[model samples]
Target: MTAPLLVTGAAGFIGMHVCEQLLNRGLQVIGIDNLNDYYDVSLKEARLARLKKHKGFRFFLIDISDRDAVANLFKTEKPSRVIHLAAQAGVRYSLEHPHAYADSNLTGFVNILEGCRAVDAEHLVFASSSSVYGSNKKLPYSESDPVDHPISLYAATKKANELMAHSYAHLYGFPCTGLRFFTVYGPWGRPDMAYFGFTRAILAGETIKIFNHGDMQRDFTYIDDIVDGVLKVFDNPPEADEAGPAYRIYNIGNDHPERLGYFVETLENVLGVEAIKEMYPMQPGDVQSTHADLTKIRRDFGFSPTTSIEEGLKKFADWYRGYYKC
Candidate 1:
C-alpha cells in the first residue's frame, strides 16, 4: 500500500484544495490545523467538513508550533511525505503582531522539520511567498535572485523558512521543495487579501483603497493553478542537483503581470458594479510590483498557469455572490 500523505494547514484555502486533489487521486491524506480565528472559523470548519466525508482523510486539530503535538502526529501517522502550509499570513497584520510570525513561521516550521527528520519522511514541500522578493526592482523574480531584504516581518519569516529547509536538506540529505507563490486568488481565498477585501468594500458601497495611486502590478495566480503546481512538485520529489543538494525552490506564478487598475477593472466587470476609488500612496510594507520568472519551474515540472484574469475573477465573483447571498 502507498504511504499516506501529511498536509499541515489542511483547513486553509490552498490546503483544502490540495487535500481534495490528493484524495481525488486516491491518496490517503492526514491533515492538521489549529483552526484559529484569523479569519472566519466557520469557513475553516466548512473546509474540514468536506474532507471528513472522505474515507481516506483523517484530520487532527494541532498547531505546528506545538512541538510535542506535532511530533506525536508524525510518530503516529508515519506519513511518507509532508506538505507544510500553516503559517501566520498577511503582511500588514504581521506589522501589528510580529511575534505571531516568529511562533508560527519560525517555531512551527522548526517542529515540522524535526518531525520529518524523526519519521524519515521521503519528501517535504512547504509554501513560501513572493513577498520574499521584497522591493526588488527586478521585473520577474526568479529562484536564483538574491532575496536578502524583506519589507515585512511575514516575508522575513518565509525567507528564513526557506533557508532553514535548505540547511536540513544539506545536512540530512532530505528532499525538500519550497514554492514561492505569487498573488493567489480564487474561490475560498483569505478575506484579508486585497482582492477579497476590495470585493467586500466595493459591494458595500465603500471606497476601495488603491495604493501607489493604482500603479502596482502583480502576477495574480489562480488557486487551481497554484494547487496543480504544488501537486506536481509533490508527485515528483527533487533529486540532488550538481550544486550538491536535493533542495529546490520554484516561483509559482501566472507569468502575466497586470496593473492594479486593470485588476480592479476585471473585478468590477465580474461584479457588474463599479468600485468607488480611494487613491493612496503605497503602504510602508507594500511593494510596487511583483513578476515571476517561471523558467526553472516550467523546465522542471512543466508548470504552466493557464487561467486568465478575466475568467478567473469571473468565477471567483460568481462563487462569492452565491456564498455570501449578495
Candidate 2:
C-alpha cells in the first residue's frame, strides 16, 4: 500500500487544486490549514467543501506556525512525502504586516522542516516565488540566478526558506524541491490579485489602478499548468550528490510574458466591459517585469507550461460571471 500524501494550506487556491488532482489519482491525502482571515473565510470553506466529498481526503484545521501542534500532527501521520504550501502570502501586505511573514514563512517553515526530519519523508516540495528575482537586470529569471536582493519582505522570506530547506537536505538525506511560480491566475484565484480585482472593478464601473504607468510585463501562468509541473516534480525526487545538497529550485511559469496593457485589454475583451485605468507611479516593493527561464525545470522534470493569456482569461471570465451571478 502507498503512504498518504500530506499537503499544507489545503484550503488555499492552489492547495485545493493539488489535493483534488492527487485524490483523483486514487491517493490518500491528509490536509492541514489554519484558514486565517487573510481573505474571505467563506471562499476558503467553499474550497474545503469540495475536498470533503472525497473519501480518501481528511483535513485538520491547524496552523503550521504552531510548532508543537505541527510536531504532534507529523508524529501522528508520518507521511512519506509532503507538499508545504502554507505561508503568509502577499508582497504588499508584507510591508504593513511584517510580523505575519516572520511567524508563517520563517517560523512555520522551520516547523515543517523539523516535521519532515522527524518522519524521514522521502521528498519535501514547497512553494517559492518569482518575486525573489527582485530587480535583477537579467531578462528571464533562471534557476541558477542569484536571489540575494529581494525587494519585499515576502520575497526575502521565500529566499530564506530555500536556504533553510537546503540546510536540512544537506544535514539529512531527504530530497527537497522549491518551485518559483510566476503570476498564477485562473478560476478560484485570490481576490487580491490584479486580474481578479480588475474584473471586479470593471463590472462595478470603478477605476482600476495601473501601476508603473502600465509599463509592466508578467509571465502569467495558468493554475492547471502550475499543478501539472508540481505533480511531475513530486513523482521524481532528487538524488543526493557528493558535491552538494539534494535540493533543487525551479522556475515554474509560462515562458511567455504578456504586456500589462495587453493583459488589461484581454480582460476587457473577455468581460465585455472596458476598465477605467488610473495610471500611477510604481509603488514600493513592486517590480517592473518578470519572465521565467524554464531551462532547468524542463531539462530535469520535462515540464513546461502551455497556457495562453487569452484562453486562460476566457475561462476565468466564464467562472467569474457564474460565481458572482452578475
Candidate 3:
C-alpha cells in the first residue's frame, strides 16, 4: 500500500473526477473541499455523492484558505503527494468579487504551500488555467511563453500560483508540476462555463450571449482527458531540465482550438435545439482566443486528447437532459 494522497477541491468538477480515478486505481485518497456556494451546492453534493461510494475515498469538509486547518490536515494525513485544485473560478465573477480570488487563490494557496512544505511531500501537482496567457497574440500558448500580463484577477492568481510553486520548489527541494488546463467541459461540469450555460440556455429557450460577436476561439478539453494527463504527470515529477524553470508547467488542452460559433453549433446539433445567440462586443477580463500548444505535455506524459467536441457535447447534453429531467 502507498501513502494516501491529499486532493484539495476534491468535490469540484475536476477534483471529483480525479479522486474517482485515483480511488479506482486502488490508491487511498483524502479529499477536501469547503463546499462554497459559488454556483449550486447541490451540484457539488451530487459529485460528492458519487465519490463517497468509493471505499478508498475519504472526505473532509474544509477550506484550504484556513491555514491552520490545512496544516493540520497535512500533519495528520502526511500524504506523500498533493494535488491542489481549489481556487475561486470565473473571470467575470472575479471582477465582482476580487477578494474571493485573493482569499482562495492567494491566501488559500499559501496555506497549501505551507502544508506541502511542512510534510516534505515528494511532489505537488496543482491546477493553472489558460487564462494565464491573457491577451497574448500568440497562436498556441506554450509553457515557455511569457505570462507577465493577466487581464482578469482569476488569471492573475493562476499566474501567481505558477510563480509561487516555483519559488517554493526552489527554496525547498520538493518537485512541483503545474498544469494550465484549457476549457474543460463534460458531465458534472460547472454551470458557469459557457458550454454548460449554453446547454441550459438552449434547453430553456433563453438567449445566450456570444462574446466578441462569436469570433472567439478556445481549446476545449474534455474532463477525462484532463484527469488522464494530470494523473500521468502526477506519477512523474519535474527534475533538472535545461530550459524549463525549477518547477515544470505544462498545458493540458485539446490542441484543437474551436471557434465559438462552431462550438455553439455543435452544441445545438447535440441538443437538437438552435441557440438564440445575442452577439456582443468583448467583455472586460475576457480574451479573444485561447489555443494550447501541447508539445511539452505530449513529450512528457504522452498526453493526447481523443474526445471530439461533437462526441463530448453529445455526452454532456444527454447527461444534462437526464439530470435535469428535461
Candidate 4:
C-alpha cells in the first residue's frame, strides 16, 4: 500500500480542502489538528466531519507543538509527504497573544521539521503568509524580494518559518517548499478575515468598519485557487541547486488586487443588501495593500487563478446563507 500523506491542521480552512482533494484522488491522508479555539470550534469540527466521510481520511487530535506526540505520530505513520499548515494565525491576535505565536509558529514548526527529518519525507510543503512582505511598497510582491522588515509578529514568525525550513532542508537533504498565501478567502473561510466579518455584519444590519479609511487593497485569492497552487507545488518538489539545497518559495495568490471599497460594494451586490459602513484609521500590524507576483509559480507549475472577486464572493455568500440558515 502507498504511504499516507500527513497534513497538519487538517481541520483548518485550507487544510480541509487539501485533504478532501487528496482523498478524492484515492490517496490515504493522516490529518492532525489541535482544534484550538482561535475561531469557531464548530466550524473546524464541521470541516473535519466532511473529511471524515471520505474512506481514505484518518484524523488525530494532536498539536504539533507537542514534540513527543509529533515525533511519535511521524514514526508510526511514516507519511510519504508532509503538508504543514497549522499555525497561530492572525496579525492583530499575534500582538495580543505573543506567546501563542511562539508556541505554535516557532516551537510547533521546529517539531514538524524534526518529524520530517526523522521520516526522511519526500517533500515538505509548508504554509507561509504574504504578511511577510511587511509594508513593502512594491506593486507585486515577489518571492525573491528581500523580506527583512516584517511589521507584525505574525509576519515575522512566517518569515522565520521560511528560514527555519531552509536550514532543515539543507541539513537533512530533503526537499521543502514554502507557499506565501495572499488574502485567501471563499466558502468556509475564517471569520476573523475582513470579508467574512463584513458579510456577517451586513446580514446583521450592523456597521462594517473600513480600515485605512477605505484606502486598502488585497489580492484575494479564492480557496480553490489556493488549493490548486498548493497541490501543484506539492507534486513538483524543488531540486538542489548551486545556490541552495532543495528548497524554494512561491507566492500563491490572485495577481489582481481589488480596492477595499470596491470589494465591499461587490459583496453588497452579491448579498443583495447594502452595508452600513464606518471609516477608521489603519490598524497596527496591517498593511495598506497586498499583491502577489505569480511569475515564478506560473513559470514553474503553470499556475493560474481563474476566479474573479465577484464570482468568488457570490459563491461565498451563497454558502454563508445556506450554512448559517440566515
Q: Count the backbone clashes (under 3 Å) in each candidate.
A: 0, 0, 0, 0
TM-score of 4: 0.99
TM, every model: 0.98, 0.99, 0.98, 0.99
For model 2, what is the alpha-carbon lDDT of residue 161?
96
The lDDT of model 3 is 0.92
Give the TM-score comparing model 3 with the true structure, all chains together.
Answer: 0.98
Candidate 3, which segments miss by more than 4 Å at Cα?
Answer: 241-246
CA lDDT of each candidate?
0.93, 0.94, 0.92, 0.96
Every model's Cα RMSD, please? 0.9, 0.8, 1.2, 0.6
Which is the leading candidate under lDDT? 4
Candidate 1, superposed: residue stretches over 4 Å from native = none
Clash list (residue pairs), candidate 1: none
Task: Report lDDT (Cα) of residue 51, candidate 4.
Answer: 97
Task: Report the C-alpha lDDT of model 1 over 88-140, residue by residue, as the tens digit.
Answer: 99999998989889999999999999988988779999999999999998789
Error of 4 at 147 (Å): 0.6
